[model samples]
Target: MSHTDPDRYVTRLFRDDYPILQGLVASGRLRRAAVSLPGWDKATVFEPLVPVSAHGDHHLRLGYADLGAQIYALPSAPYAAVLRASGDYRQPAGIAGLQVCFGAPDLDAATFRAELRASLAQPLKLDSTPHLATADHGGCHATWWPNRTLILESGGDWFLALAFNLETRVIRSPGKSVFGIDLNADPALCIADSAGVARMIGPRHALLDGLRREHLDRPLAPKEVRVVRALGYASGRGPLEVALRDMLSRAEAVGVEKLDTRQLYARFVERSREQAALDWHVSWLPQALYRARIRLHRVDPAFSTQACHRHPSHLGIVRGRMFDCPLCTELQHRDKNAARNIQARTLAVHRHPR
Candidate 1:
């Protein structure tokens, strides 16, 4: 058993349109109560569904005999209509959801707490945060295979595998892969290594920007403006996902641990001060990295133009966006070089540990 799992896995089940077994939690009879499977006659129990992996790409397997049959018979369905996905916020732009058209049972609040005093080795920590997106509540039915443990939940049109597990460990990359990135600089995103080798990340904002111009350009009435705003809201998250996926693929290939970039927080602050209305140039890369278990670091991004890798001591002349030193031979793009220096600064800061 992995450390992420408990001695005996216990999955939480919430009853739909019913009191949450309040008597059990209040009576001090049980530390936590296992919910009753609706339409269950208290004979055969809900099938025990357990989560195998913790952080990245989790999967559910039934703790039963007919695993093959269960996998072949999961209630999955497709969307009824096709939307352009150009400007939809309620629906996922790139992510897909599992939907159950018909095969789930209604849940009930009726439950009996197990006298699990012997099951305790340590005090159990319960997370109170309610499931925001999909809850195993409401009138949406769920399927519980033989033996109560996990439930196949239905939320209106969406189907979800609602498994109860002891704990899950976050997946992480092995070690540090130090790289520098300059956002909104010459090549948009430039990742450079310690060997002075550099690579540019594609899937630039050009396509999205073109769509914004074509669909969201100004000089229009209320409806067009709404359409454009919706489009931006819908498609805005895609570029960051692309960049993050690209970064992850590269980082994994080279075992990247720390990604150093300019502190976008400060940039956003400065931009907000400059503009009357607030405009946020937020990147979901950091959040994505966090989810992917990658480390993120930042450095003062002002020195890229003033210095080059070849000679950190000598300041170079900035020509528009490029930087060059007359005394030294080669020339470097300001942002490109800055990208390298950013990584250097981060590594130096980390090594010194002031």
Candidate 2:
């Protein structure tokens, strides 16, 4: 379903007044536990919440709806007792609180609640938390911690949970942003900025097109030759001459197995020479073309690094290399910069009117 429905979406928030609830249960200090649902005012209790199957283990097995159930059952006991019972199971207590937000357009709340209840009834194992953060700029679902926050476009439909130290209400932030250059496809270079923004550059074809357009009336240079060579290597093709020579060698190799020694040798030699010429042409042609484009356009290499655009001086430093602007205090997005730059340029142009 489309990502525009609120009913298809759910967000759950969990908080606690303590830390390491699981350890407490394991040590036998906490006997039972329960949780409250988002709209509920009370907690449901689980008397003797520790399951028979959870013997000798400490954890909690509460789910989104179970939290509500615990609250609904809370009138029978004190709130603390309910919490103790809910957390009595062998499930890892690492999840101090959980927020379950769903974006399923066809979701049936009753069915979903039932599913949640069933899941909670089973023993729970501690697992890694998925990155899902909501902020004013946009939302992201992190697959891995640190810098790999995949920009999530839910169209408004999604589910998420948060875990943290119960006492402080603070989630341990994954310390650093992970940055890498993804160059396997389309030759685009990507960098995860320090502020959690990713920037990409160099789809060679597009860059080439831009270069050509930008430099339609200029003389090519020797430096341009180097850039073109670099582009050719990036595209996995060195030169036309080299490629032709390689093809000729392959054809001759196939002929050698036919037992026609004289014909094979003649073809092989002819093909080898042709292939060498092709390889030479391939190597130089792209370089020449690239040089011409650059000389004509005066294009500079595009830089893709993580940095806060707000403060361009604050570059992002990773592995002893300066990758992003350090001065920007906030996370900067790659796409946002294009808009920002455009606006800045527009304003400047209007102000100066050159």
Candidate 3:
């Protein structure tokens, strides 16, 4: 079983289908509740289907088990005929600007291209445009056997191709290697290796740190305590801290603002420049710990709030409290979770039999 071999294990593929799912629900073929698989007791599954047009009607599909089988078994002649009749199925004269992943070993580039052309030549109202020229410019990487391919959509767009290599017993990569993370206003930090050191820093921290130093000569206000808290400080509370506490209390009276002390501390920095700096430090601290090679795993935010770590038997118990793990559990912020998941994925790639 080589790392790149696809026959070693069961395979699953997830696709970006929110747009398509919305279309399907609009067309009245599926209900909003049917979007995800329901049997998992351990994790939440969100499978949104993408919209594709065929036979003069818009349809929703995902690049997974059943859908893959349907595409593979689709008769070439009829499929082409349907596409041609649709009038919207014209393939650009050049490369198709699309990314595709194939799960079957029998399928190759030529067959895949043929199938796609057939599908596109139909009189379907495609939700997306066919910009075929962008396809050839992108590179392709694949693992043989069960045969999984991820095609990068070229032309400098945000488009991406992702597929599961079913032959390997590995989970999806959590962070950027699988999906891109956009850090605009939110403070984000990244660590690249097992040593658990900071590799990339966001601008929020630098800005706050500079402000704190500049205000060194001025008397610290009570509000400044919240700012210092953002930096992971434990000194006495400042005026900003008291004001925030009061505001939170008022919000709670109105039936809003349910969060834990740690979360509150984590978000304090977002309140002010001083606080924002602190927020960066608190968020980055976990990454630093991971980079230092500490054997720790971050909590999956998806399950953290909804499920209890100590009582796995109790599922969907959302108590509106900050989720805390047992002493045996690892504490990780967002970036750390991503970094660790990527590392785990890379290790799985190397460990699979070649």
User: Which candidate's TM-score is highest?
Assistant: 1
Residues 84-188 of candidate 1 have per-residue lDDT tens digits of: 111221221112211110001231111100111111223322321211112221111222222223333333211122322111122334554556665542244
C-alpha positional error of residue 145 in candidate 3 after TM-score superposition, expressed in Å = 16
Q: How would you encode candidate 2's per-residue C-alpha lDDT over 85-138 as one tens digit per residue?
A: 332332322222221312233434344334434545455554322111112101
Q: After superposition, how far is residue 46 of candidate 1 from its true place, in Å?
A: 39
Best candidate, lDDT:
1
- Which parts of model 2 are misplaced by more than 4 Å? 1-101, 129-354
TM-score for all predictions? 0.40, 0.16, 0.20
Arrange candidates, best lDDT first: 1, 3, 2
Superposition-based RMSD of candidate 3 using all C-alpha atoms, in angstroms: 22.3
* Number of clashes recorded per candidate: 11, 47, 30
The Cα error of candidate 3 at residue 111, in Å, is 45
In candidate 2, how many Å is residue 235 off? 37
Candidate 1 Cα deviation (angstroms), residue 271: 11
Please give the TM-score that candidate 3 achieves against the real structure: 0.20
